[model samples]
Target chain A: MRLELETRGTRTDKGWRDHDGFVGPRQPGTGPRSDPRGDFPTGPEVGAAMPDLRCLTADGPAFDLHAHRAGRPAVFIFFRSAVW
Target chain B: MELQKSMRDFDAANIRVYALSYDEADALRDFRDAHGITYTLLSDPDSDAIRSFGILNTLIDPNDHPWYGIPYPGAVVVSAEGTITRKFFDNNLAVRAGPERLLWAALGEPVVEPLADQPAPLGVQVRVSLDGDHLAFTVQRDLVVRFDVPEGRHVYAAPAPQGSLAVDVTLDENDRLVQRPIVRPASEPHALAGTGESFQVHHGVFELRLPLAVNSFSRSAAPDITISGEVRWQCCDDEVCDPPASRRFELAVPVSGPPAHALRDSRAATLEPNAAAHFRRMSERRKDPG
Candidate 1:
């Protein structure tokens, strides 16, 4: 599985630029190689515990996936603002 | 969205539908009100959910414009226990999980059905025949279809505008033909062509012919060919067509030999009693509300 991380806005040539990042290389047998500036973190690092956040529904109920899972199953979806 | 409409018709309750986005609640509320959306639309303003799902686009173009950073649209079926049953995270935005297909998945029904109605909003059918062992024919090959439109109803001509009647037919798995059928009145509308036009007298009976190629068969030994496609058309009997509904049909055709060459015997035969009977039975139950 390909993994990605959220980098703070410092273009240092090593962190992911904009929001885009590449997962595993298309061709197999080739190990992942980071660029000189180290733009993207390796898959293992990015795959670490994902950050949990709160969501507000139209009904005004606040939801947090980590707390709501309660040892059960939950689906987290991310969508863009239609305004954009 | 039409997805909700399909879900309502599917009549299943086990799997829940939740649409999430990074938009704020106010934006989601506005969208819901504008579209009269009936499904749940959750807000993920901070991109946390988007990041967790790993669907966010983050690529920047050479022009310095950010092209990636949005979540890749997809659907995931989670079992009651929370395990992921199925996940589809492709980049195609227009494609979605069909209502019936989702129901079937939740119900643990077989992935393939022998008689799922091919949803075609348009009114056109193509027939093909297998000659010997090589070559296949398409509508361009002289295979003709005579649509028996119900009284007071008319099907539009080909090359229809988007969201208009545009029927298509293609051979499915397990299907092999000698010659593919062709369409007649190549340039004239169905109402104008008069010749090679067929009509339906009652509510159910409709007939069409298709030609096939000589070697349309796959290497499999099975004699069944799966016909899968969508139809986009309007059906109105002098008055109303419920909305332009896009229906999909997946059919399994048993290939024995080539369809008889004689015009009188050229009509494609319907499948006999099979699993389709079960579907019809279910439809019957739904129709009887009481």
Candidate 2:
């Protein structure tokens, strides 16, 4: 079976397992294209349109980013880990 | 945790703060209850929102990390028109932009000052606190020691075996105590600008894990023990290095007997994986001491 690994800015099928015992998917690298415009919009740039987001709140309530934003300045924080 | 404390400032500034995470609702709820977090926590178990924001951390190999889906740890300020106004992405993931930094980005200046309760010892803010809400004498505990340096200031990492003074932690010698400071090894090698001397230095806000244990206690009721220690380090900035200094801290830990049926917490937010593993090994070595 063929497996894919994304390491060192490229894709390869080198080692079966990483040092941490992880097996990556068998696929090509998904790096942003050199032609910046071709890259997927990961985040909305300054003055650019914000991406739509719909998710559940901690209380299990549906939350729409656009609805909450409501033409008001909003701050979004992405945390690394709560466990540590 | 810093965000949770200064939530009032965010609210008063007319800014709506939303916490985005890949954790499920249950885990987020547990975290909220445990930490008393009073913000809206948006759950994205599949990291859909994270990817949408282009903040998903793809550096980790998923096979090894069951909880690999995470953001790079950052904050973004968006305007009313659904456009990002300002963003802060830091190299140090452990210490991201706190309320102070975020307020700067949002308001274009420093609106809120540092809390007076946090004193700066040797021009560095040292915050020490126990991991959980309380400590139990039945098992070992962990303490989090955070050091925050001001703008343009830096602190030297622990020196080599034969090197001079650096950041170090030492507990007061006590027969009933088995304490060890589990400091993370610094791998970022920095070179002094002029002298070209290479040394490891920790900039901005960095944290240390301190492991403490209680050997024996005979108190029927809960007892409070003062854990005294000194954090020694040499502060420096781009200009010059200051004299070596030490900041003393006395943490009062309340220890009581275990409950009738105490259940282990398996949640990721409360579990320090590396520390737990190290503690397990230490316990095994103690049991098999030859």
Candidate 3:
């Protein structure tokens, strides 16, 4: 796992970079690799019941996943960020 | 985001969609208003939910500033009963699960797209089609190669009997395209009658799905990109195996514009006039909160 590289503090060459380019505290790739074999810890198993999620909505309302959806199918996504 | 484009299909299928991020709720609100995002956007500013899910990207150091506290981006599809039917967590930060793939996982079927009229090999039908009308950076869509093997016939699966070739799709070398390994259906075991040999084969109907996304760094402004590839297979029955066959395919796939995040750049901000303002506010808020 390339993730092991993260443990080596400030070891590798590539510094932080975003859309603006070459932006600090040294890391390896600074991002995920493209290999499909990377079986990163993907949370719960497929058949496992989804844990209830409690968080704030974009509108600042307290949102509860299971309660709001109420037995409906759902696609829950975890993304990097809206901001760069 | 590609999810916005597929909102209609998800709605039609009665599947609710929600995206969560570590950003503050206000930032997400601004993003939604700016991009006309129809689905729900959740906020986990403290990364509590991210940690609970066990997908928090541990790669970034504690003091990595804004890069820290982010999850390894992924999507999970929940059945009506709340079981996690499928999950797409790519190691690549740029690659994301296309909406069609999510819909397929939720629907428990292939999201079928009719292939353009083309002749098939004798007794076998091969159809290849893409899930979306266009290809975009990071958002993955399936390049589906379907095979309809005639009854009493089968195609060699991977590790095809030494000399035989497995049914597979190989895209020509293209720097613009990034592809994941082909998703093959479970191959059936075929037992030979005389020599006491057994091998894997696929009969009837099956598909080999190539999850493809455009490399964001390709930096092309063209309206369409030519995606060419070859499909090769050797069809065989109990007694006879046809010679290895291959057919080359070329598709002019339309190009989708840069993702919503790219709108923050001055050039792309023209698409949505408020993009730059929202981006400024978001970056300012997250900037070195010491």
**Model 2 lDDT, residue A42, Cα:** 34
List, residue by residue over B128-235, the lDDT tens digit for candidate 2: 886544454323355667777776777777663244467777777653454543745453567778888787777767776665545323223547667788888877
Q: Whole-model lDDT, candidate 1?
A: 0.40
List model 1 lDDT by residue over B1-290, tens digit each: 43445446333353455677755576567556655666667776555666656555443221221223345555555455555555544232212333444555555544222224755433323233321222222101212233434444554445544555543443344223332233323332332233453332212123233443223113345566554544444454433343554545554555444322221232311211222333343234334525
Clashes of 3: 0
Which stretches of candidate 3 lie above 4 Å from their native place?
A1-3, A6-28, A31-37, B111-122, B260-264, B267-290
Sort by TM-score, best first: what order?
3, 2, 1
Worst 10 residues of 3 chain B by lDDT: B112-121
Tell me the TM-score of model 1: 0.37
Candidate 1 per-residue lDDT, tens place, A1-84, comes to 443333322232332222122221211111111111223221113214434445677666986644544543333333333333
lDDT of 2 at B155: 76
Per-residue lDDT of candidate 3, residues B1-290 (tens digit)? 67898999999988999999988887787778777899999999878899999988786665655566788889999999989999988765667888877888899875434345844345778888888788887788889898888779999999788888999999998867878778988998999999979999998778899988886656667878888999999999999998999889999999887664445466545545655565565455556555
TM-score of 2: 0.44
Docking quality class, candidate 3: acceptable
**TM-score of chain A in every predicted structure:** 0.34, 0.42, 0.58
* Candidate 2 ranges with C-alpha deviation above 4 Å: A1-42, B110-290
Best by DockQ: 3
- Candidate 1's C-alpha runs over 4 A off are A1-54, A64-84, B9-11, B60-68, B111-290
